[model samples]
Target: MFEAVIWDFGGVLTSSPFEAFARFEAERGLPADIIRRTNTVNHLENAWAKFERAEVDIETFDRLFAQESLALGAEVRGKDILPLLAGDLRPEMVEALRRIRAKFKTGCITNNLPANAIGSAGGRTLYIAEVMALFDHVIESAKIGLRKPDSKIYRMMVDALSVDPAACIYLDDLGVNLKPAREMGMTTIKVVSARQALAELEAATGLSLR
Candidate 1:
């Protein structure tokens, strides 16, 4: 049903960041949605969007993210929490990506920070290296100044992969990110669990990822 597959790096390819965020909240006694709420401070113009767009440097993002979160409640030190965001890679997803790439063009569209910004500690560098080797086209928001859920980034990914929206299926953990891709006529999968995502891919492309 699709000629191309698009993957989201942090949550879909890797274990969901929300899991780590949950651990952080439990450990720190912070609210459940503090991190997400902080990210939505200015909506599209929030610190996260700006950082992903490369409009703000790491230092600036640290300040802005801290300020935004502080206004809500707890004082979240962006630097302290940055390392926790690099969730461990899902080996099954990596294998599935490789299987899909053999028959379909694959692209990775992610809203991520530059390594320099996040300090690249906690095995992040190694994780990225292994997974990046699997993708044919990687559209990283930090590198491109375009974040997901924005219609433009979705267009950029398919065009760069030499495919059209209708021929592509995008998998993302966030509904917000999936919205624009679906609106652009790409088939969409909301990747809530590794098992479910693989099943969706199998149904979409007739590939036995399991």
Candidate 2:
């Protein structure tokens, strides 16, 4: 039986940020595809991994992003990049997390930028805090100097929770992020939708959700 549940914060708990990015880019007179492409590149180096790991500060990140945008032949600015981080909480997912917490040791495993800049960057801390309160532990990548898809971060979580890898179920929106966790022997769930994810959880743990 799975004794613990580790959830990714952005896509799993909330609506995907890509939606916000599309809207934001549309308003900025830039093609949504350009913004999306820029964001894709940003994710590879600047956003989640580096920020979560504290490898780069907000200023450095902004500079790097601007440079990347210029390199891509776009005029994207830091202000424009903010909307890419917006998130909305899904009530069903929040309730499901609560239910999971009541029955199993629960944790938040998120790749996030620094806490101070989250609000300005369109990151939702208040919403995150509400859902995170339900968890036994919260691991933010920035504070730990490790990011997702890295075996080290997964190991860190397993050690911190004191749970065997095989006894934990790790849910992430990104399949790549879940790869290392699954390799570490943790039960992995790729969260495509709140309903489907919850159903998977129910099957994995035999916890009926009414």
Candidate 3:
């Protein structure tokens, strides 16, 4: 029933950076979820959103994010958080992507920082280059000046893949991002864990993805 399988890169294919955020908060004695709260406060217009869209440079984001986090309570530099965003990749998810790609078109939509923004190639570039080669198409927020939960970006992927929305399966870790695709007539999966996501993908695609 699906011609394309679209994925969100951060949480779905890699270990959630939220876990890293939690550890950072614990280490600093800040309240839990402070980082997440800072990002979701203004949602679309927040410092995090602007950074993802490449609307601001690293220096600007560092200042803006510090101010935003301070307003919420603790002050956290954006530069510090940039390192946390590079989550370790999940091998099972990558394997499933390989299996699925052999049978269906595969695409990736990632809300990411500009290349080298992390200040260390080891964090993202090395593994990222290898995994990115698996995708038939990739849309990055920094490259396209568009981010998730935007209907237009989803439409761009469908058009790029030349597939009907109704015949595509989309997976994301965020409900806000999944909502747009779900509304676009695609089967949407909110990835909570690799095992759970693969089970659902197997059911949806009739493939033995483990």
Per-residue C-alpha lDDT of model 2 across residues 41-121, encoded as one tens digit per residue: 746565435656888777776776677776777767654566567577888888888788888888888887776665643
lDDT of 3: 0.93
In order of lDDT, best first, we have 3, 1, 2
User: Model 1: which residue pairs collide?
Assistant: none
The positional error of residue 136 in candidate 3, measured at the CA in angstroms, is 0.6
Q: Which lDDT tens digits does candidate 3 get at residues 70-160?
A: 9999899989989898788899999999999999999999998987897655455667788999999999999999999889999999999
Any runs in candidate 1 off by more than 4 Å, and if so which? 121-124
Q: What's the TM-score of every candidate structure?
A: 0.94, 0.86, 0.97
Cα lDDT tens digits, model 1, 1-210, are 578999998889888777787789889999888997887777799777888889988888888888989899987877767877877779899999989989999999888887577666667687788789788888888888888778888888888999989999999999988999999899999999999999988999988996
Tell me how far the alpha carbon of residue 21 in candidate 3 is from the true structure, in angstroms, after superposition.
0.3
Candidate number with greatest lDDT: 3
Winning model by TM-score:
3
Error of 1 at 86 (Å): 0.8
